[model samples]
Target: MNNFTTFFVSGWHHIVDINAYDHLLFVMTLCAAFKLKEWKQILVIITAFTVGHSITLVISSLGYIPDNPKIIDLLIPFTIMITAISNIRNYGKEGVFSNKNVKYVIALIFGLIHGLAFASNFKVMMFNDNIIKPLFAFNLGIEVGQLFIVAIFTLMLFAYSKILKGEHLKWNIFVSGAGFGIAATIFIGALS
Candidate 1:
């Protein structure tokens, strides 16, 4: 494969990998609160996350951010736990997160944490001579992977909405609860 394709595929698979699914779980929880109709808001939230991680990825790649695998591993699952709990708390009370600003801020902050997680591996793969192309391509691949995940999640929500009829909140709560459990497990593992 070509260089661009190699980098893109590597980045894409990095996020979507089934064995290492912290990223997937985080994205699922992040987008779980919104319905298909709220695509614009979802896009913004996802973009904010992308921007957060992209900034850190660049900084970390340049060696500006210190490596702390233990802290980052803990934070990765911690962020997921936070997002999942937030969704659970806001289950029926959609008004709580009516302010998009709060969501954006959360996404950005959590995205930074996630970026640090990404940076550990990213630093290993980066080339010193040509950082820009690979970095941009990698980030782009991540965005595309995120969009793909959102699309699948949106379809599942749509199906649930259609079949269950007004049970979207329950579905969100259930999924978020599961995510929280998974994240908690990972967090405990990290502590050990």
Candidate 2:
């Protein structure tokens, strides 16, 4: 395969891979606060994350930032936990997040940190002189991967709410709590 194709696949595989649960958890937590009817907001939040991470990836490509893996690792889970806690805190509050502007900015900031967490690996993946094409392709691939995840979560959540008449507050708490628990575990593990 060509360079773009190789990096694209790598990006998709990296996000969807089960071992990369931190990224997946972060994405899921972002979506947990919204209902099925709020898909547009979800997409915007994910896009914000993509944009933020893309910025970091580009800057990292230019060798501008320090690659502190330990701190990045801790920050990744911390962001996830914070997002989860936020969702849980606002559970059942309809208009609490009605204005999604804050969420977009938060996602963007979190995305920047998440991108830093993977900067070393992403940098190593670049082998060609032409970085723009591969970088664009990789970010596109990651976006697609994140969308796939959002789609699956939306469907499952939708089914629960529709078929079982699931309580929105209950689900928000459950999903967000799960995110918090897992991220806390990761954060603690990284502390060791």
Candidate 3:
């Protein structure tokens, strides 16, 4: 099967391919750290992340930095791992995050790193003056895919927390982070 077929065969696969395990892991880690259920908090964090990533993606595509696909691929997962680490260290037994601003800053940084990762996906595409149209379309596809995953997760959590009464936030962070770190390291090694 083609890569695209493999990607779209399942919602889970699609989410993983377009968004990457590391990006999802980092988002999961953030959700765990903050345990935020309110729409306002989600909106702010999502906006910050989207803005930060879009800026870097556009800049990288516009030739602001030397495009190194393998390097970016490595850094994408590393960024997620680091974000998880930061989340762990930022707040200690104080009940959730210590400061919202700190989370925002870290999210912005990770988002930029993720932008580079996203740009790396476009490295093989032929670039010309008309490249921007297709690039934007690809990015929009990614965003739509990401949003679908987020909405599903949110809905699942809403139901579970309210009806089934199951919450595994902290464990989710730990597991996702550790798994992402290992996966990224292996992927990077393979690329090298």
For residues 1-192, write the lDDT of model 2, one tens digit per residue.
998898889789768999999999999988998999899999999999999999999999889989888998799999999999889776665564545897899999999999997788888988866779988889889999999999999999989999999988888889999999999999999999
Score residue 83 of candidate 1 by CA lDDT. Answer: 91
Can you list the residue pairs that collide in candidate 2?
none
Question: How well is each residue in 127-173 modelled by candidate 3, as lDDT tens digits?
Answer: 45555555455545555655665676677666666677766455445
TM-scores of all predicted structures: 0.93, 0.95, 0.67
Best-matching candidate per lDDT: 2
**Model 2, runs deviating above 4 Å:** 92-98
* lDDT against true structure, model 1: 0.86
Error of 2 at 97 (Å): 6.6
In order, the Cα lDDT scores of the candidates are 0.86, 0.89, 0.59
Relative to the true structure, candidate 3 reaches a TM of 0.67
Model 1: per-residue Cα lDDT over 1-192, one tens digit each: 766777788778877889769999999999888877789999899989988988898888888999889998899999999899888786556564646788998899888889998787888887666788888888888889989988898888888898667587888888899899999999999999
Colliding pairs, model 1: none
Clashes of each: 0, 0, 0
